[model samples]
Target chain A: MKTDVSSRVVDKGQKQSHFTANLGSRYTIDRIFKYAAWGATGVSILILVWLLVTIVADGIGTLNWNFITSFPSRRAENAGIIAALVGTVWVMCLVALFTVPLGVGAGIFLEEFAEDNWFTRLVEINIGNLAGVPSIIYGLLGLAVFARIMQPITGGRSVLSGSLTLSLLILPVVIVSTREALRAIPNSLRLAGYALGATRWQVIWSHVLPAAVPGILTGVILALSRAIGETAPLIAVGAAVFISFLPEGLQSQFTAMPIQIYNWVGRPQEEFHYIAASGIIVLMAMLLVMNGVAVYLRNHFQKDF
Target chain B: MTDNVTGDIAPGSWSPKRDRAKAIQTIVKIIFGSFAAISILTTIGILATLIFETIEFFKEVPISQFLTDTRWTPLFASKQFGIFVLVSATMMISVISIMVALPLGLLSAICLSEYATPRIRRILKPMLEILAGVPTVVYGYFALLTVTPFLQIFLPDLQGFNALSAGLVLGIMITPMVASLSEDALYAVPRSLKDGAYALGATKRETVTSVVLPAALSGIVSSLILATSRAVGETMIVTLAAGANPTLGFNPFVPVMTMTAFIVQITKGDAPYGTIEYKTLYAVGMTLFIMTFALNIFSFWFVRRFREKYD
Candidate 1:
């Protein structure tokens, strides 16, 4: 007790304390933590750069006109992605055609038209759940339904099946993004349309939809990009990885860039690996273009809002 | 008042144009309403297809042996229908990926949310998210060709087709999900909490480590859980880089087959439609669906439940 009191008296008397905040390792710890945080961010960026550099370095050699124009071959030098490229374009176009109207219409209904009721809420919640379901599950659904259950329409594992599978895989994304775009429009803008003697449908079509076009287009492009990159669903729908011809029609069998890339990556040859990298380069270019446009659209519209 | 205003516009004027407008509105509403039903119809289709095909699959492979057996050699002569061979592989890859992602993602989130200036974060956030945009198949080849070779230089025994490499690339792929999510969580933590820590003479490190982390723990955990589910559902990366050999082991260095890969594998070949072999695809998908659905619901619940609370 005496020592404690004497120590307290000494501490009170002293102008400087021995155990100060900056007098020890506290500052060092703080700086270290800050640097560690920065380092972690750097590490992720570094990895992305490394992966990109490696892909470009290995794949750029194979990404010539010949590669894009020629068909797949057993010989690595002769192998190309002409068929896969065409199939991917066809699938993307069909996927975009199918998803945009349906997805955007659904988003419009749920956001602007649907009443605040249990059924609307259920649809909303189910959309969220569907967004979380794996792409492969959608593939199985496509296989069972489009390819088999609706055989005549889908032609059982044709381009139609592939595109439908991909559309389902990306439908939730499109709907969610569309809703976001729609939600960005203020309620006052919507109310003004109504106040101007416009019906709900008229208001949505003339004011709400037009104002939100940029955002909606951005969302739609992003969804299409996701669909284009998808492989499993297409594979499950029986996309041929070795096709040498373009899809002649919606009922024609097709292959896509990702499946081709996956096929090459699974091969034992070192050359095929390089070919796989080239396919990835093309796929990445497509994705980047799509995402870039989406980003541009979003930024362009966000300023006014 | 409303009736008076309407009477002023046009008393009892139900013109042909007005009638046509009403009809068009109803048609438009009906069309969009049906569009909305497509999602519900899609869900029913998925569930019905899975259930119907899974029932057929179960008749061929008994549920008991399928669950209890240790082997999963469907293409082999023996034909052991064990599900765990794929389950364990999926788990092993997911575990490795989570191990890689949680730390890196959390740290990156902390950096972006707490440490970096808003200006820096604005640039860094999108840059990190770009990782997510790269297709999984691209990542698969990147893993098989680039990452595996890079790792083989260190662990010479690491197989060319190993879970570690694929999982590592997958970890990189999903890092944005974790970082973006956890950053939102950390950002939601009331600034007052950090101020209190500062008033107590806590350093910046201490304020973040003690005050902020506990507050945002649930969001970080949920993000990690969601990332794990993503890794589980990932197909091409595992299918290409992780090998098709469905071994019942947990070694990260060896080749392992995932359920997604197995489904893709059988369906890629000439498995006759409605046959037992083809039905296996649906069976595997059912398992994958249930696993991911549970994880997603848990993640959703966790995010909703324990997010930061303020007056």
Candidate 2:
């Protein structure tokens, strides 16, 4: 009996140590994983910082008033971004003009009027897929349709065509955001508007639309920011790379900031790379401003009720 | 007598203004409906354009040659139209990108969702958003000028325009997207699941790995797939950084050309309308479209099939 009791005590002690050893390993793994996760996050932030620093360091010397004012030239030192910058402004304005009404209107129709049917479902699915469709595909569509089939109207790969293509590209984004913003407006608000004997259109126009403006604006700004940075679609639509003159109107052939940057970057000359970086700085500044506005609008106008 | 009395009262109640308002409402609805229809029209237009052009292309170049040709010198004098050359290069870069992106993205998502404090989460989220919002063209520039040179220090043989730098930059570019989407998925995993794991003496790491991640598996998978699709479709970084060498080899150290890059190459050059070279763009585009479209559909289907409904 004595021997058995001692053996059982020894076994219990061994089991405890084994359990603790297992836990020690587990705890070590937990600590390692925690640090690994932190490292991953750190690495991502580090890359962003590195990319910015590199661009600024490389481009700051080239970024001057002349760089912004002068037209693109064969000489790397002489090339300026005047033509591309103006073209970007024109395209952005037209994109905003075309997309807002169409995107917001579609969002309103889907959220307010469309019933739960196959057609609504199809539209919803189509938008989702369209959002995933590569921007280059949109470029091809623009190339084929707006630039070719509708050449008479779009003037063939003009600023109007580019803007129209971008409008289509970002329409899904705008519609989704508009729907989200509209969805956030309390049902009670709509109900109260109806209780006041307002028609559906009246309530949406006077109450819901007003409430959703900030959200829609935020979405629009972000979408425009995206549109501005876009290069491939414009390239596919055949935006000229060496235009010394600025676009006169919507129908005129144009080059935007990205195309100019792309053109500069493609050159074998190291000087062109510097100018490319400078152009990127300008583009980044524009994006930063627009994104700042979007973030501000979102935070400032976010409503609880 | 009742009908006469009702008719007399109805005119005043249903005023001309009411008729006008009703008419306006109908007109507005129709207009809005047409606006909605435009999105559909865009999709139809894309399909119609691609199909027509692609058909025209296939009429000239046999499908068998397109599939089997070992070389893709569509612009050259020899005119060999082998798509595998472009596909291989595209796949090589995308594979490299996914290699970099998946772990970084998944880990970031895990940390943000499972470990980060609210303060940290708030700061990190916007930072990631900023990363995402930075232009692809900028990334392309960074890849060509900064990353490739930096990479050349370690890899002496790495070309100035190679897949490695492009893939690396592309990976970093898409990481934020993957992280954001995966974080959403991880956040969607219910509290009860983690609690149960903890109650069973699982550590935080164990709970996340065995419980939360498993539950959020579908979403993470979908996010990864979507990011891969984005990588495949990515143009500027590859066009600028990955040189326009359409070789049928998977070498990250060397230059490569992706489908999107090829399209850019063709369009940037003067392939006037109604030419075989121009038609090749549509053919290649059709292939790219199908690839991304299939991946997207698969991702959507996966989410629908495997999403864990806690409610």
Candidate 3:
């Protein structure tokens, strides 16, 4: 007790005492934490740069027009991705065609009409859950439903099956993003439309929706990028491992860039590995262009809003 | 009073037409509402299908043997269906990935939320997220070609295919997921808390470590959990890079098969429908789904409970 009192008196007697000591200690810790944060960002940027550099160095030379134009051949010297490229484009087009209307319509209904009831909340949660479900699960579902169960068209493995599976995987993402975009539109817009003697449908069609288009397009593009790169579900739905021919219809056998890359890289040979890298370069370029457009639209329309 | 005022107005009035429009509005609302309801129904139906098939799969294969048996030889008539080996590989890869990803992810979040300028973050964060937008299959090839050779320099015993390479690449792939989610959490932290720390003569680092990070800990943890789930459920990386040897071991240098990989493997082969081999895919899938589902649910709860209580 005596020592404690003496220390307290000494502390009180000292003008700067514990305060300066605390400040010094805090300064060190603060600097360390800030640097730590900086280090993290630096490392992430480094990894991304490493990936891009390595891919470009390894794959860029092989990415010539001939590589894109030629068809796959059994001979290692002659094989290319013409068939796979065509298949990917077709699948992406079909996927976008199918998902846009259904996904956007669902988003509109939820944003404009659905009440804050238990049912609506349930639907909202369900959509969130679906978004987190892995792409592979969707593949298995596609295998069971599109390939096996409904085999009248595609006999269990075709471009159609692959497209159906990917569409399901990304549908939730589109819906959620679209709903967010719609929600960002202010209530005043709706009220003004009504005040002008416009009906609910007319108001949504004319004012609120036009305002929300940029945001909705952003979500749609992201969804497309996701679909374009997916491999697991397509593989599960029996995407041909060595498809040398182009797909003729929805039901015809096909391969995508990811599947082709997976098959080629798995080989023991070294050259096929390089071919895989070239395919990756192509895939990444496509994704970048899509994402770039999305960013541009977001910025352009955000300014308008 | 309104009638007297309007008595001088024309006979072709807007008020009656507006009433008719209101009636139409109610009908349109019902139609839109039904469309939303059906979208929900489709989602539910997918879940229903998975559950129904999974139950049938269990009936054919006894639950006890499926969980307890270690050697999975479902291809043969004997059907030695133990899922431990595959599950162990999944767990091992997931742990390694979390080790690599967590620090980088959290650090990046801290940088974006507390340190970086708005202009810098706008450019940097999206670029980082572009990594996420890259297909997993690309990462798979990068792992097999680039990462494996890199690992071979240090670990001489490392095979052409090993879990270390796959796990490392997957860790990189999942980094954006963690960073983005954690940043959102940290950004939600109110400025007053940081100001209070600064007013106490605390350094910027002290303010961030002591005040900002704690407030966002729940969000960071949930992000980690979600990233781990993604690693567990990841297929192409493990299938392509991680060698498909369903052996119950822990050596990172050795080839190990994961649950998702096994499902991919059987489906790739000519496994006939209704055969034990085909059914095993479902059984394995059910296990993987249950694990990821449970983790996701836990993560969702954690995010809600630990989220910052902002003004």
Candidate 4:
């Protein structure tokens, strides 16, 4: 009996050892590929890091106080980016003013008032499609509509036309964000409002709207950031490539940072190229600041519920 | 008792007034709902305009020539109505972009889902998204000033503007989309599969490859397709970095005009609205919109159909 048991134990040990050997070799190969995948991801991050560092180092020298205050000069050597900066600010401000009410109102209507039916579904799908539409298509639309059809209204591609074009482009984004915000609120809150003798409008205005405010603001900021950097649409709507004068009214022509950058980069002069780099830095900074603000708002108001 | 009777109006009597209020509410709802309805209508109208204008363009220029002719010199003469030359350029840039984005995006998804701890993921995910928020115009500048000069040092023949540089910049610009979507997909893979592999004495690497990745493959593939669409539709980076040379060449070293680049080129020039050049812009725009629309619809369907819901 002892001899038989010993033989059986030896057979079991052999099987186990063979299994371990095969498994160990397989694991080694697997680990190699896993690390290889990681290395690829690391390379992408490294590329982005390199880009940020290079931009800061090369563009920072031109971001001095005078660069902030001065306007473009004919010599290119004396040009600053004050006009572009002001135009970007003006465009963003107008974008915010136009998109907020329109987007939020649309969101409220869809989420609170519209019936849960095919028409609502169609609108939802449409909004998603619009969000994916190319920004340059919006540019073409602006060119045809805002710059041409409404030429009698604005007298040409002015600040107002550019802002309206961008506002339309980003409207879907804001509506999506706002709808998500509204959806996050509990159904029980609405039930309680109705129980308290509140009308539908009253419940939305007094309860739901306040709950969704932070989200609405967050969307507005992000949409404005997008509008600010948009060059193609503005270019299509005829943002003057080198507007030396500040825009005095809605009818006056204007140039944003992107147009300014494009104008300078195309020039043969190396100095203008440096100025373009400076303009890029300015545009990047604005985007970063707007994004930061949006993130902060998103985090600050994220409900535990 | 009489006072109580008067106070408690019959429910049937109360119903009429409530119905009246509901009728008013319905009208109010319709009025408010018009905004969303009209916005969608406007979007469709834009697409229709593109279609009509493009059709008009095709009428003026033969469809056979526009589709088949290899050389593109519409500005100089009507003899060249070829769309394929510029389409090839766009494809070249998009192919390069996809080559870079695919592996990086997949691996990043793997890292975020399988390798990183919660603390690391919380920090990294937002940082990756921040890349997406950086404007394409900025990426364009980065390509022109930094990337081009950096590439020039090694390749003496590289032009100041080349497809490779633009494609590289677009690759970076598109990475965030691929990564985010793939991460969401990876996260949806069942954790039980990993546990089962571990119970069978499989290593972490084996579990991720055999169990997790296969399960997430469809979502990852869809993300890649969507990223490809974004690369095609992207205008600013190509317009700035890639020069306006509509040549039928596969060489990434050369500057080439993309569809978007051609639109930018035609629109910038003084082309009248009724002219063939202007209508060609609409034609190219329609093509771009159609391609992107198909991709978008596919992605949406994928998300709706295959996206796993974890209870």
Candidate 5:
């Protein structure tokens, strides 16, 4: 009986050896294709490099102070981005003002007060769906609602109308991110706050907001950057591409960096194309700066938590 | 836990501090509730605007003609409002973009998940995010001014403004999105399954193919669906490179206007606020909105259906 058992164990060991199965073309193909995956990443990097190179080559000369300070002109050399720059800043500020409070408050409610029931689940799902809605569609809503329906209030395609549209566009993203930020806090913090005499609002105000600030700030910056680059929706809502003056208030007509770049790219003149390249460089720089702030805040908070 | 609080909360009397706290709590609750309703209100507003305008547009132009006709010349002296012309163009670009995004995206994701070292992953992930963050308008500019010109050199017959360049660049924009989502899916596959494959003397490739890929199949599929939705709704790239011609054809070499481009075209000109021409935008928006809305729902549902829990 011992001899028979030993023979059976030896047979099992032989059957389970690492090289029991012969290597074949399938394995070879997969091994070879691993490099193809790396190659795919390389190709993406190449295209990015090429895009940056092409625009930088064309646009470098147009990045001087005069380019930023001068007003729009029939002459490409004389036209500056003062109006577009001002309009972009105005719109971003208004978007920040409108989106932050509502987004953060909604996030707090969803994380703390929501019952985790079907109604709250539906709301969560609805927010996700809204984030995917095309910006151009938002433009249509803005056109109908802000530009026309609320004409008396928005003053018809002024910065107010444009800002409100952008606010609505970014609100979903803000809410989602803020929820993520708020959710990162430990439940013990809430329980401890309640262990004292603190009300729910007081606990959240004192304990949660400080902890979530960095994450919320990161999300807000990214959302604002997205709003900054948006052009199609603004186009839909009647942003003039060639505005040469600043928006004095919320109701004034405005032009943004993207709209300006878009118009310059479309002009028949070669110089305008070069100018468009410069505008692109500026836009890209602003994007990088915003992203930088977000990264810094994220790192600082991550180190804390 | 509640007994002390209940005993402290006497029926008919309150201190000034408690009264203030109660009032503040009531106000805060109302504020938060209203803030939460903003999202719902946004959805309602979008639907109402689109539907109201679309209903008015259909009263003038029949739905059957809008869907079935072959031409879409809304602003011409003689009008033929065929929605298929735009739908086909949108489909053609969407299909081309998917073809470009899928292989590149999936391969990169597989490579990152299955092969790359942690250091490599950290480096590659940020590069991908940077790629993703480059704005669509910038991509549009590159597609029009750079990619189109480069493609014309090889395919000499390619139009100055054609679907191929726009589709290709849009694919580039979408690849990182696909890679990130798919990588998360692949990462979620349990390690024990992979170890089991190894224990059974399977090669790494064999293990991934038969074990991991199948395990992550629904996630991969949902990523594809989400990518498709993104391509369908993309605007600036197509607007800049795909030309404004609303031609009815499948040729990626020729200039064709997508539904998004049509909306941009009409809105840029702002035909006349209440004209049928103006209301045509809402009809187009309705179609675009419906397409994206349905795709997003399907994506979420597909993901939930295949959700896996591992010990």
Candidate 6:
């Protein structure tokens, strides 16, 4: 009986040591993991900070009123982004004009009017697929359809073609966001309108649209910001790199800020790289303003249930 | 009864204003319906454009030669149309990017979902999104002018336009996307499961690795696939930094041209419409489109098939 008791005591001691060892190692592993994750997060933030600081430091000296106003030149020092800037504005305006109506209408139809069916499902799937398609592929589509086939109407790789391509590119984003915004409104509002003998269209126009406007506007602004930064599609649509004059109309050939920046970056000169950095600053500033407005709209006007 | 009380309309008679409003509603529905159909039209346009041009391209270059040949020198006098050269380069860069992005993105996602407080998440999420919102052209500039130069200091043999720099920057560009999607997935893991793990005397890391990660596997895989698709379709960074040389091997140090980069090169140059050279762009694009489309479809399918249901 004495020998059996001693053996049991020895077994208990071994179990205790093993448990403590496992606990210590587990804690150590957890600590190591925590530090590793923090390190990853730090690396991402560092990269962003480094990128912005580099661009800003390199370009701040060259940024001036003339840099924004003058035309492209053969001399790197004299060259400016006036043509590209104006072209971007022109394209963005047209893109907005085309995208908002079509995208919102589609969203309203799918969310409000259309019944659950295979066709609606197909469209949803198609839009999802299109969103994942590369921007360069859209550029190819624009080249074939808007630029080549519809040349008589689009004037062949003009601002109109670029705008149309970007409109298509961002159309999915707008439609998806609009649907989400519309979906967020309580169904009780629609039912109340109907109970008051309101037509569907009347209910949508008088009650639903006003409530969803802030949300839809925010989405549109974000989508436009994305469209503004697109370079591959613009390049594929044949945006000029060295247009000296500003775009006169939708039909006029043009260059955009990104395409211009791309042109400058591609050149084998140090001065052009600095100028490209300046152009990027302007583009990023525009995006920042747009995104700021979007945030404000979301936070300031968002309503709770 | 209401009509009789108002004395404005007969019970059985059609009111002109009501008829007009009804007609307007029908017309409005048609307009909206047609607007929705535009997306369908876009898909059709892409398919039709690619198919027509691709068919034309195949007529000039045999399918076997296009697939089997090792050289892609259609622009030169000795015309060889092997697509493997470009595809190999594209795959090499994509693999390099995936290597950099997957681990970094997943770990950051874990930290955000499991460790960060709500306020910290709010701040960090937007900061990461800002990284995503930076334009691709800017990234290309950074890659060519800054990243390559910096990388050369460590590896002296790195070319001015090497795949390593382009892939590395592309990885950075896509990290936010992977993190955001994966965080959503990890956050969706049922709290009850995590609580059970804690009750069972499991550490946070053990619970996450054994239970949470397993449940969120489908979503994580889909996000990875989507990121891969993005890398495959990336154009500007590859074009600007990865040089125009279409090589057949997997060397990150040398200059390589991706499929998208080739399209950009052709588009930027004077490959006039209807020429064999111009047709080759569509051919390469068709290949690229098929690859991305397959990946996207697979991602969707995987999510639908394997997602863990908590309810």
Per DockQ, the best of the predicted structures is: 2
DockQ of 6: 0.74
lDDT of 2 by residue, A176-230 (tens): 9999999999999999988976778888999999999999999999999999999
**Per-candidate interface DockQ score:** 0.72, 0.76, 0.52, 0.45, 0.63, 0.74
Which is better, 2 or 5, measured by DockQ? 2
For candidate 5, write residues B1-311 as lDDT tens digits: 44555568779464335556768987987898789888989999999999999999999999999989889999888899998899899999999999988988998898899888898989888888888998888899899999999998899999989999999999999999899999999999999999999898676777887898889988999999999999999999999999999999999999999999999999888567779988899999999999988998899899898866677
Query: Which digits, one per residue and each the tens of the lDDT, describe model 6 over residues A43-117?
Result: 999999999999999899899998999898878789899999999999999999999999999999999989889
* C-alpha DockQ for predicted model 1: 0.72
Better of 2 and 6 by lDDT: 6
Top-down lDDT ranking: 6, 2, 5, 1, 3, 4
What TM-score number comes out for model 3? Answer: 0.92
> For candidate 5, lDDT tens digit of each residue in A233-272?
9999989887777899888999899988888887779898
What is the per-residue lDDT of model 1 for residues B29-111, given as tens digits with 9 covering 90 to 100? 88988888888998999899999889999988899988999988888888898998899999999988888888889999999
Give the C-alpha interface root-mean-square deviation per candidate. Answer: 1.0, 0.6, 2.0, 2.0, 1.2, 0.7
True lDDT of residue B48, candidate 4? 74
| DockQ of predicted candidate 2 | 0.76
By TM-score rank, best first, the candidates go 6, 2, 1, 5, 3, 4
Worst 10 contiguous positions by lDDT, candidate 2 chain B: B11-20
User: Chain A: TM-score in each candidate?
Assistant: 0.92, 0.94, 0.90, 0.90, 0.91, 0.94
**Ten residues in a row with the worst lDDT in model 5 chain A?**
A1-10
Scoring only the second chain, what is candidate 5's TM-score? Answer: 0.93
lDDT of 2 by residue, B1-311 (tens): 54565577884655334456667778898899889989899999989989999999999999999999999999888899999999999888888898988989999999898888899999998999899999899999989889988989998999988999999999999999899999999999889888888888787888988889899999999999999999999999999999999989888888889999999999998788999999999999999999999999999999999999897
Candidate 1 residue pairs in clash (backbone atoms < 3 Å):
none
TM per candidate: 0.94, 0.95, 0.92, 0.91, 0.93, 0.96
> How far in Å is the alpha carbon of A271 misplaced in model 3?
0.9
Worst 10 residues of 6 chain A by lDDT: A1-10
